[model samples]
Target: MFKNHPKGLAVLFFTEMWERFGFYTMIAIFVYYLQENFKWDQATVTNIYGIFMAGVYFTPILGGWIADNVLGYGKTIIFGAIVMGIGYAIMAIPTDNSYLVFAGLFVIAIGNGMFKANISVLVGNLYGHSEISLKDAGYNIFYMGINVGAFYAPFAAAGIKSFLMNNFGATLAQGYNAGFGIASIGMIFSLIIFTAFRKYYQQADYQSKKEVKVEKDVVLTKQQEKERIIALLTVFGIVIFFWMAFHQNGAALSLFARDYTHQFVGKFTYLLFDVVSLHAILFAIFGLAALLKKSNSSKIKSFGGIFTLAGLSLLIYKISSLPESGKISPEQFQAFNPMFIVLITPIIINYFSKLNKKGKEPSSPAKIGIGMLITAIAYVIMIIASLGLAPVYTLNGSTSAITVSPFYLIGTYFTLTIAELHLSPMGLSFVSKVAPPKMKGLLMGGWFGATATGNYLAGFVGRFYQEWELWQFFLILIVCAALASLMVVFTLKKLKSATS
Candidate 1:
């Protein structure tokens, strides 16, 4: 599966892995830190969350322009990483001042905007126009690297906070800062790896738009460029709803895990919350699949056997070491989405690859529509789970303190991860595949621009968490996702033809 790709893919993969580790680490603790540090209500916290996420995505427009026009993708990425590291350091200062927290988030947002879109553009730059199928597959591989970091981030946050608070008798605020400090170190590692591997991806790193060429400067006509941009903008506008719903993982969903969902678990059920165990399971599954395949390559089979044994050994080791029962953390529940991404991305890619071989693969837009429908299905689980739960606000104007099984949030995240694998990576691939070469960076940023809108909307929607019944709030998301899916279904043909 890793065969015959540009060496740059690996370079960018690991670079993104560490950067995302830091970002997700911060995200896993963001709202909790706010609530604990400042005593902000849900509305205020959600609004801030929405704005911060929006800024994180929105700044990419300028970041992409900077890469295209000034510093180049490589320099921009490095600069962004450094800025993010500084921002994380600022957040880790172990102070009680709230403005410093906002200031740190602002800096991180600026840096992420510079970093995110350009690296993705670099990924697309690695492939030729004729390699669209291979390009999509490559993005899936790259996306998995991102999730590997994300999968570890929550655990890292949990472990870091626990260690600081328990071992050093640190306060809660200090523990949160310690996690942010680890996030800062993650950025440093990202910078070192990406800088060291510069040779591998140097060819793709154009210092300016004049140097950019995909397939020997094949230029788009005015009409073609217009149509493609229109199509991409259409898709981007629709997926805003998807992000609005999916990002709830950080806002309403996190709160649900903290307040509305049961956190205690048995040894077996605790597997979901334990990153080490989940990581072992991923290795074992991959190994078992490889070993079962009728591969002619002895090397592949041997590698598979070794991985299988090692993974199972690790799992056994973990099982013996963990407590029989314990309370899981809310931040830990956020890891499920990334864990699913790591485990399932290959399957999704392989499935599409099979369909491609038979000339039956859905167009990117169609798959996106399917993903939106799935997003709706994901929330249906939440709606059901909320059926017996207390209303967020009641007739007496008092909120209930009821909780449900953690499985609801887990299941919701799992289902949403499926939607994300389809919508998000495919969205990035769509932008990379469809955008005109000259406008690649701008339009790529536009994708994030749309995400900025969606993420802001996520926090906006999160505000209603305190206003409506829990089920009603989720139902709003379901309606939005379903409507977005319908829009795609209606526009699928036009979208496909434009991209084609």
Candidate 2:
């Protein structure tokens, strides 16, 4: 999977993996921390989530500009990581002051702004224009690195909380504090890795001023530049609704897990709830991948068999250790999307590769449009889950006794993960391929800017979780996603031409 890519790709991949570990750990607990410790209502908590997430994604504009004109990509990433560490440390301090926590989040966003866009731009810069055929695949691989960290994050956060509560008689608030501390450590690891391997990806750290000198042959006429920018903006505008629908995972979907979805289940039927159970499945998956690969040497297949045996043994041990039933955390449900992304990325990449080989691959813009359609389909599952449930406002903050099965959410997340693979990475690849070199950073920020708008809307819409029926809220998302998909159909030819 790593073959043919630059060595720097591996460096950036690990660095990003650790960075996402930190960010997602915070995400896993951010809402619960607010509601449990600060005693905030769901509306307020989700709104605040929107603000923090919006800022985190939106700041890339400044970060990208700084990288392009001043600090360059490498320096901005380093600076951002340090600032993020400080922010997490502040969040780790034990306190009743909500303002302080809010301040910490703001700081995290500032640092994230400087870090996020530049790193993505750096990844895009690794491939020259002649290698456009490989660019989408490259971004797909990078996206997997992000999900690998994300896949483990909720488990890490939950494990830390469970350990502290069991051993130290810690409060949930204390568990949250400790979890935030772990996030800081993750950031530190990211900073160290990036700094140590700085030279490998140094080639991607192009300053805007150097565009004329570095790649002078790929000149864009003023008219061509205008058309390309317009094409990108069109894509950005349509994708806003897709993100607005997708980011509901952190807010409305999370609430559904806690209040509306069944949390307790029969023995071994709840692997998503237990780390050991999850690990058994993870190990078995890797073992099978290695063993099933036709190209693997016999020696490698032997190791794969060993791993599979170990995983089976562990699974048996885990089942014996479990009681009849256990309650699951809402945060753990968030892991489903990322884990699915990690598991299925190789398949999606291979699928696209086959399509490309057959001369029938969808244009990047077309893939994004299909993603929007799939997002609508995902919400349809939610609409089904809501079919018999009472409205949340009527429940008065109590967990529903007639909760639907966890499969509803698991299915939704599985479908949404597929949508994410189709849209998010493709969008990044599209921007990198189309954006004029001089404006790469800024245009990349524009993509996140659209995401910022969508994230805020996710928060904004989350407030209506009570005001509207569950199906009503989901239907709204379906409408938005479908409309965006329709928009893409109308503009497909123009986008493909511009990107080409």
Candidate 3:
């Protein structure tokens, strides 16, 4: 866990934690902000959300290129952080014009393109050729840091917006920028964390001959490189559908939470939901303890255990004291996926570690294919959940919203989180492992570029929500994910060969 891995992992973990905090905070409330503030319709909001998300992922190609050939990963990450901070600041400004919103999104996208793929490249660079076996585990641990941030961001958004509305008597539209302001502050914290720990990252730098051997001099046959590249791109092609389905959390899923879910809760039901959250916290604490146990250093193990227990205790104490009679909002539901990630990541890691020991571990491509299939199952759950509910928006016309149990969404998110653990982090590991050393950043960017395509497709699918029944839309996603899974499985032998 914390032992044997590069110390740079801690720096990157905290850096990504704060970055994701800001990103997910903005995401949790973004579409609502657009709709309430600008009086936009659902189709327009979903489309805009899709396009903005696409841009956020799309810029990584250029960012990765700049890092690979120009500035290197470290400087690119720092510059990207600054640019993103500026973007967040722009969004935070209390302005009546919607132009600021789009402008802020544009800037954030540019900065993210620079930051996201390159940092992942840095993470991969942390482990050497001999340590390749640990790469997936390293990514799993790093990924948990991301979820820790995502898990709590919605709470920050909800609390900030609630404070502004209640304390200042501000309208929802008027007060939304306060949430954006909180996001900006998160970015500031990220920059501080990264700067303070910047020196550690140098330990993992391949360019620094004094610290690690440079693999850049290793040569491969052109045919070998070509085969690997084709294999990587094939996996990338299939995962496009996975992201298309997975990202519906922010777009179509957000709309469902707002319009279809039974959000209103009595004290008893609220307590029940709180119990679920408490279970998640307890699981995270135990997971952290298990990870700490793997540390070679006694001090790291003891310190991590105490720190984790204390932090979890504080979280539980805070949650227990929250008033329980109010309705849960759409934004609050955003916590479920990250919460599940925190709870389950260790389990997945341990399972894979066991498989590796037994010499039965699946290749990254197979895992990704399994993930695509699992994602299809998530949509299938959604389809079943929508069985009895009348159309919120039918082709004939809009109708009264039906309040289904929150459990439907909870279940949907649960399966999707599993799919993500199997695909997303593993996808990052695959890119890092398979790509040529000199071209790592560029190919990592390619992985995210595939994600951008999928997200754009998600928005395209979302735009059709108005035209079809709820179950029908879910059916479309299921088909896409299933088909992609089949494509990946079809090419499995080739993928394994190239990766080997």
Give the best candidate by lDDT.
Answer: 2
TM-score for each model: 0.96, 0.97, 0.91
Could you give candidate 3's per-residue lDDT for residues 1-500 as a string of tens digits? 56778898988988999999999999999988988887788889889988988998889988888888888788888899999989988988877787877899999999999999988988888887656558898898899999988987888888888888989998896567888888888888998998888888875544322222455223557888898899889988999999999999998888888777787776545543453455545645774775466644676666657656765776667567767665888888788888889888988998999999999988888999999999999999899888877665552333336678778899999999999999999999988878876678788999999999998888888987776888999999999999999998789999988766
Where does candidate 3 clash, by residue pair?
none
lDDT per residue for candidate 2 within 446-480, as digits (tens), equals: 89989998999999988998789999999999999
Worst 10 residues of 3 by lDDT: 208-217
Cα lDDT over the full model 3: 0.83
Candidate 1, run of 10 with poorest lDDT:
392-401
Q: For residue 217, what is the lDDT in candidate 3? A: 25
Off by over 4 Å in 1: 214-217, 394-401
Best by TM-score: 2
- The TM-score measured for candidate 2 stands at 0.97
* Higher-lDDT candidate of 1 and 3: 1
TM-score: model 3 vs. ground truth? 0.91
| Candidate 1 C-alpha lDDT tens digits along 67-104 | 88888898999999999999999999976788888899
